[model samples]
Target: MISIPKDDPAAPDAFPAAPGAPSALETPASPSEVPKETSASLQMPEGLEFYAPNYICLTVFAVIFFPPLGLAAVYFSSKTTEANQNQDWEQAYINSGWTGWLDVFAILIGLAIIYVYTLYM
Candidate 1:
């Protein structure tokens, strides 16, 4: 209130207080007495979290450098994302992990092919 401009007609001198506002002393003194959760505290284990991570995009870009690896990564990423959407956490986790391996394998294979071509062809 002090920081607000006094000259500004839009600003009020003081904010209006709620009628029958409960005082701190009148409020729940004990932590246990105060109801903690306004809503359900625990969620029933359900629903899919199809969150697409940025690595999927990175792996797609890898296609330009290593076609096989990039393709594999994209495949794994798609599989995992689908599983996640289906509420299949295990499959999602497994596929997501494999996507990284695919990207690495693609880079290595691309390099290997280039090396072979340069030496032999």
Candidate 2:
């Protein structure tokens, strides 16, 4: 344990304070004086909020089961949505359909390779 020396010139007073610190007795400003703007005022992109869930699920399934088909689906859906003026459910539908097709393609390719190897050996 350590003890402070009373006679030391470097020792601080009991009520020691900083030069720029606000006094404890002072009160904060009223609510009316504070800014009214809040983070909730900001708006997110419509496409992002609408299509994020479908896009995520399709992309995940594609990656795990069919890389090529997944790539194709991602490519086509992006294109169709870009071409149309009224996006509607275009993005979601395209993504799901394409992802499913690609998965099927991948499964077929795997089967073909297996068949060829079996025949040769």
Candidate 3:
């Protein structure tokens, strides 16, 4: 069993009371007294845009039709999203292209398999 010292700092009376501070419920006397937005709170402008398509939906659709290539497409789609979040437009574009191609290939291959199975049997 663990034992705490009699003078443990974690005790409620161990520390002195803090100095008086203004309560959060109090409102500023004037608008100017309110805190202003700082550069740290600012966000990037909305003008910047990325044209790459993540192909996540198509990848999910492909998963229902084909598991192997569909899973690969999902990986590429996640990479595209990660690159986009990192602001690496080039990598995002490349990953998006790979995701799109994988999605298409998975769907096509699945259809081909179904067609061949129906024809043979």
Ranking by TM-score: 3, 1, 2
TM-scores of the models, in the order given? 0.47, 0.33, 0.61
- Over all chains combined, what TM-score does candidate 3 have? 0.61
Please state the error at residue 41 of candidate 2 in Å.
11
Best by TM-score: 3
| Tens digits of lDDT, candidate 3, 6-118 | 78777665444445533567778888776666433442554137646887789998898899999999998889877766667799899999999889999999999999999
* lDDT at 39, model 3: 37
Clashing pairs for predicted structure model 1, backbone only: none
lDDT of each: 0.70, 0.56, 0.79
Q: Global CA lDDT of candidate 2, please?
A: 0.56
Model 1 bad stretches (over 4 Å):
1-54, 111-121
lDDT of 2 by residue, 1-121 (tens): 7778999888877755555544677544776554444323433466445542235455555555556666675675565454332344556566546655665666566567678889998
Each candidate's number of clashing pairs is 0, 1, 0
Candidate 2 C-alpha RMSD relative to the actual structure: 15.4
Between candidates 2 and 3, name the one with more favorable TM-score.
3
lDDT of 1 by residue, 1-121 (tens): 3577789998888775556544546777677675544223332344423443526666865787698679879888889777766556778788888887888777777778889999998
